[model samples]
Target chain A: MKTKTAPVAVDVARPRPGPLALLAGARRGRRKLGRRVVPYVFSLPFLTLFAAFFFLPFAYAISQSVFKQQRSGLGLGPPTTIFVGLDNYAKALRDPQFWDGIKRVLLFGAVQIPVMMLVALALALLMDSAVIRFRRFFRLAFFIPYAVPGVIAGIMWGFFYSPSFSPIRQLATTTGLPAPDFLGPGLVLWSIANIATWEFTGYNMVIFFSALQAIPQEIYEAGRLDGLNEVGIALRLKLPMILPALVLGLLFSLIGTLQLFNEPLILTRLSGSITSHYTPNIYAYNVAFVDTDYYYGGAIAVILGLVTFAFSFGFLRLTRRQSGV
Target chain B: MRNWRHRASLCLALFLGVASVLSACSGGGASSGGVVQLTFWSFNQQITEQADLFNKSHPNIHVTALKQPSGPNQYYPKVLTAVKAGNAPDVALIEYQYIPTMVSNAALVDVSKYGANGVKDQFVDSAWAQVTQGRAVYGYPQDTGPMGFFYNSATFKKAGITHPPATWDEFAQDAVKIHALGPNYYITAFPPQSTGWFQGLMWQAGATWFSVDTAANAWKVSVNDATSKKVASYWQALVDKGLVSTVADFSNDWNAALNKGTIASWISAVWGQGVITGSAADTKGQWTAAPIPQWTAGAKTSAMWGGSAISVIAGTKHPQEANEFAQWYLTNSGSLSIGVKEIGWFPSNKTAQQSSDVNAPQAFYGNQVVDTVFEQAEIPTTWTWPPNLTAVNQFMGDDVNAAVANKTPIVDALDKLQGQIVQDMKSNGINVAGG
Candidate 1:
C-alpha cells in the first residue's frame, strides 16, 4: 500500500525543483542534483520490490518455460533440468486439457460478463436517476458481496449449490418440486458464474455509478431542451457518455473471468463435475504445485499472459472504434 | 492502449502473485544444548500425541508436530514450500501413494543411512519395498491400509441376507437382495471420485497396475489388462443394474445416505471405520467388519485404500535426529498403542500390530475386533506406486466418474486413461514400458 504513494511523494518532495528552479541561483543549481536524486532514493524500495517480485520472477518463469526436467534410469534421483527450447510451449499449444480449460473460462466469461454488466448498468442507471428511495442502503447492500473475499464467497456459495446441505433445495423439495442439481455436469459452470456475478456485479456497478456521477447535469438539461423525456435522455445521452466506463467495466470482467479459479476450486470437493483442470489458472496452479511440473506450468502462465494481453488490447480497440461512431 | 505497461503489470501481478508467494516460507528449527528441536508436519492431527511422547522419551530430541489438513491441495504444497526453503520439517507424514512423487522430487532424505536397513526385518515387506526405490530407503513404514468389508448387519437382515458375502459372486447376489428391500436401498455406494478405492479393488483382483522392470529401467503399466478388465466389468454390472449407488465419497450426500441406511455397506480400509461411525453415528451397533469379499470363495487377498509413512525431509538440518525419530516412532510399540487410541492407524510394524491395543473389540463396530478381520486379507506390499500417481489418480477419477454417470462401461474408462497415464509418465522423463 505504501509502495504506491512513496514514488509520487518522493518525486514531489525533492529539495531541487525541476528545470524551472535553475533560473533561481547557482546555489539552487548546486542543490538541484541532490533534489533530483531524492525521488529515486525514495522510490528505490518500491522499484527494488517491483524488480524482485515482478521482473525477476517474470525472467525466471521465462527461463523455466524453455527448459524441462528430465530423468532416466528408473527416474529415482533428482531430475536434471534440460534446455528444450520452446518444447514446453509447443507441448502446451497442443495440450487438450490446457485448451479445454481456456475454452471453459471463455464460455464462462461470455455468458457471465454481459449479463452481469447489464445488471450493473441497470443498477447504476437507477441510482443515478435519483427517483429511488434508500439509495445508500441499496448501494451498500449490493457492494457487500464484493467485500467477502473470493475464497469465502466461493465456500459460502458451494454450500448453497450442494444438494444435501442447501436450504433452497430443501424448500424446493418440500414444495413437491424437483430441486435442480447446481453442481451437476450440465449446470456447474453456470453455477460458478452465478457466484462470480453475485460477488463482482456490485463492485462493477459502483464503478459505473461513480462514472455516471462524474457526468455534468448540463447534458441532461440540453436533452430536456431538445424535447426529450427522462427515459429518452437517459438512454441516448447518459449511456453514450459512460462509454469509457463501460469499456473499463468490460475489461475488468474479461480479466476476472479468464482468471476464474477460486469458485470452481472450492466447489471441486463437493462436485464430481468439475475436473482437475477446470480453468487455466487452476490448471496452472495444480500442474506447478501439485503435479510439480514447473516448466509446463510456467509455459501455461506465460501463454495465459499473452492471451490476456491480446484480449484486453482487442476489446479496447473494438470499444474505441464503436465510440468513434 | 496508452497505459499498456500499467495494464500488463496488473495482469501479470494477478497471475503470478500466488506462485511467487511460495518463496516466502521462513523455517524454524534449531538444535541448542545438544537437543534437536524437530518439526513434523502431519495431516493426522492426533499424531501429535505420539510426538509428545517422543519428546518426553527422547530427551535429546523434541519433536514439534504441526497439524496439516489432508487433501489434493492442502497438504503437499506446504511441504513443497518448506522443501524450497531448504529448512523443511525434519519429519512429515506422507501417504504411501504420494511417496514416489516426493522421492522423484528429491524432497525426502533416504533413511537407509540411519540404520534403516538394520531395522528392515521389523516392518511389513511390501511397505518397506514401497518406501524404497532400489536399495535407498526413503522413510519408515508406519500405518498400512489392508481393507475389510464393513456392512450394516441390520440392513442385511432386513434384506433377508443370512450372512456377509464371502465371495464376489455372493456380494452381487446380496446387492440385488438389498436393492429389493426398498426403492432407495443399495448394497454400497461406489465412490465415483475415488481412484484409490477403485485401485484397491483392482489390487484385490491381483491386477498389477504398475511394476518396475529393473533391467529395462522402465515402469510396466498394466492397467487395462485382462485381470483388471474382469474386475471393472464385474463392478460395472452392479452399477448398471442400480444395485450399487454411485455417490461421491466424503460428500454430504454420502454422509446422509449412510446415516439413513440407504447406503448399507462399504469395502473400505482400516481408517474408513472412523468415516462410517463418524458419519452414521445413530447406527452405532448395527455395523460390523468382515474380510474383503474375494474373487475366489476363500481367497485371503485385500487391496489397500489409505495409508502413510513417516518420512524425514531431504533438507532437514537434523537428518540424524529426524531419521532417529522416524525409525523409533514407527517401530516402537508405545507409538503404535498411542496411534491405535488417538488415530485409527493399522500398524505396518508386525510386532506392535499383534498387540491388544490394535486388536481390541470396538464398541461402535458392534463389539467386532475390526483389526483382525482386515488383517486376514493379504495386501500386496510390492505394488509399485508410480512417481506420477497424482496425475494417474486424477485422470483415472475423471474417466471413471464420467463413465459411471453416463452409463458407459467402466473398463472403457481404464482403456481411455491408459494412454494418458503412460504419456504423462513419459513426458516427465520416466521410462514407460511400451510407451
Candidate 2:
C-alpha cells in the first residue's frame, strides 16, 4: 500500500488547476475580507463623525483667523470686508490685555494644576484603598459636585463669594476673622481655582480610580512577592501605570484654566471685584457681545484654540519624552 | 443568519436614533386644539405684567413669558441669536437703547401698520421717538424711566444738607459735605456697571458720545472731545477725592452699601425707586425722590435711563393678537396701576402717568412724590442712543472702571476707548457717523 501511494502522487501537474484550487482561492479571499474590510467598516462611523464636527470647524476657525474686516470712512455705507493677511493675528499679538490674560492663565495654571492634580490623586488612591469602608457612598459623595452644571455651579459659588449674602462672610464676621474678599485682585484667581477644583476634582479622581482598577491584580501580587508595601506599590507601580490618565487630567485642567469665564462673570455680577476683561474668554465675550466686534472675537477664539492645542500637544510630547514611551 | 439578524437590529436602532434626533431639531410648534401658543420674552416688569394680563383676557391665545438673565448687555444678543435661529418669541421686551439695533437688524415688525386707532398718542415725545424708527413703529412704549435722584434722607440729614441740589456745582458741594462725614460715603452714585448712566451725564452736560454726518452715515468719536473729557475728568476727580467708592455699580457691594447708608444718593430713573425702596425694606421712609442733578447751568431738563419698550417680532404668527395685547397692556389704566403699585415701574403712556396710582406717594419713601418728581425731569429733546449703544456702553463702562481701578489713566483710557469704540462700530457695520 505504501508503494501504491507514492505512485498515485507522481502526477503533480495537470493542464490547469481544477475547481478545487479556485474554491480554495475564493475561501482565502473571504478570509482576507473578513480580517481587513470588517475592521475598517466598523471604524468608519467614528471617523466620519470626527471629521464632520471637530476637524471641519477647527479648519474653518484657523482660516477665519487670518482675515479681518477693515472699514473705511464713516463705516456706514456698505463697508467692505477685505482680507488683511495676518493683521488680525498681529493685532491680537500686540494687544497687552491679551498678553496679560495669557500671563494670568499661565500663572493660574502653575498654581492650580499641581494642587488640583495632587488632591485628585490622593482622593483616587484613598478611594481605591482596600481599607476604605463604604466605598460606594464615598465615591458618590466625592462626585456630587461634578454633577452640577458649570453655570449653576458658578451661580452657587457667586452667592458664596458675595459679601452681602454669603454665609462664609457671615461666619467670618461671627468668628471675628477678616472676610477675605474672594473677588479681589489678590484672591480672584484662587477663588476661581477653588471653584474649578470643586467642579472637576471628583471627575478627575474618578478617572484616576478607573485607571487604577485597570491595573492587573497579577502585578500587585508580584509586587507583594517582591516585598513592596502598599504605599511602595502605589508610588512605584500603581501611579506610574496610571500616568496617562494623570497627564490627560492635567491637559484638560490646563485647557479649562484658559477658558475661565463663567466663574469670573458670575462673580463679577455677585460681587464688584472682577473686571470686564478679567479672563480671556470674558475678554472675547465682551468684545463680541458688548463691543460688537464679532470679527475680533473670532480672532481671539482662534488664538485661544491654537494655544490650547499647542499646549496639549507640547505637554503630551514632553511627557512622552520624559517617560521614554 | 444570526449575524445578519444582529446587524439588521443595529441598523434599525441607528435609523431610529437619527430620525428622533432630526425630528427633535427640526420640530415646529403644533397648535393644540386650535389654540396658538405664543412665546413672549420680557426684561421689564411692567411689560411682562401687561403680557400676562393680555393672556388672561384672550382665551384663544397662550402667551408664555421667559425672563432673560439680567442686563441689557446679555438680553439683546440672546434675542438676536434666537431670532436668527428662527426661535424668537412672538413678543419681546426691548430697552429703548437697543431699539436702534433691532430696527437695523430688521427684527421688529412695523407697528405703524395698525395705524393710530388703538395706539395711544400720549406717550412722552422722547419715549415715542425711542419706539419709532424711520417709517415704522418698532414697539409701543412700555415704561418711561425718566431720570431722577433718590437720596437716603438719613444720610442727607447726617450731612446736614437741605434740599437736593439742582446744579452740578451744588451737587459737588453736597458730595464734599457728605464725604466729610465718612471716608467712602458719597453724595451720589456713579455706576461702573452702567456706561449709559455716564453717557446720560455727558448729555446732561450737553456733550455727545459721537457726532454723525447724516449724508455719509458715519459716526465719529466724540468721547475724547471737550464735553466728554470734562465729564470724565470730573468723575476722575471724584474718584481721586475718595468720595466715590472704588466699588463698581450694580454689585452686591453697591446694593448693600445703599442699605448701609454708604451711598447718600443714587442718580437713577423712575424704575430705581423699586430697587432702593424694595430691597432696603428697613430704610423705608428714609428715602426721597428729587430731579437728577443738572451737569451745569443751561443743560437740558432731563435724560432717559434704564427704560424698556414692547416690540412684536417680525415673523410672529398672530400679529393682531400680539399688537392688541401690547397696546392694551402698556396703555391700559389697570395694567399701568399694577406696574406702579406692585413693581414700582413708571407708566410710559402720557394718560397713565396722569393716573392717581402714578401720582400717589409711595409709602416706602415716606410719601415722597416719585411719580411727580420724575415727571418733571422728563426731557423730550435730549440725548439719543445709537442702535449699538449697548456696545458703546460696554466699552465706555469698561474703560471708566479701568480708570477708576487705576489700571489706566483717565485720559489714556478715554483715548483707548475712543479708538476701540470707533473700530468696534465699524466692525458691527453700524453707520459710524449716525452711531
> lDDT by residue for model 1 over A13-93, one digit each (tens)?
346766644444445555688899978865665676788778888788888888788877566678889999998899888
Flag clash pairs in model 1.
A16-A35, B126-B381
After the best TM-score superposition of candidate 2, give how far the Cα of residue B92 lies from its true spot, in angstroms. Answer: 1.7
lDDT values of the candidates? 0.84, 0.74
TM-score of each candidate structure, all chains considered together = 0.89, 0.81
Could you give candidate 1's per-residue lDDT for residues B36-120 as a string of tens digits? 8999888776778888888888899999888887765557766875686576788998888888878877899988888899988
Model 2 residue A12 CA deviation in Å: 28
DockQ of every candidate structure: 0.37, 0.25
User: Judged by TM-score, which candidate is best?
Assistant: 1
Looking at model 2, the pairs that clash are: B218-B432, B218-B433, B219-B432, B219-B433
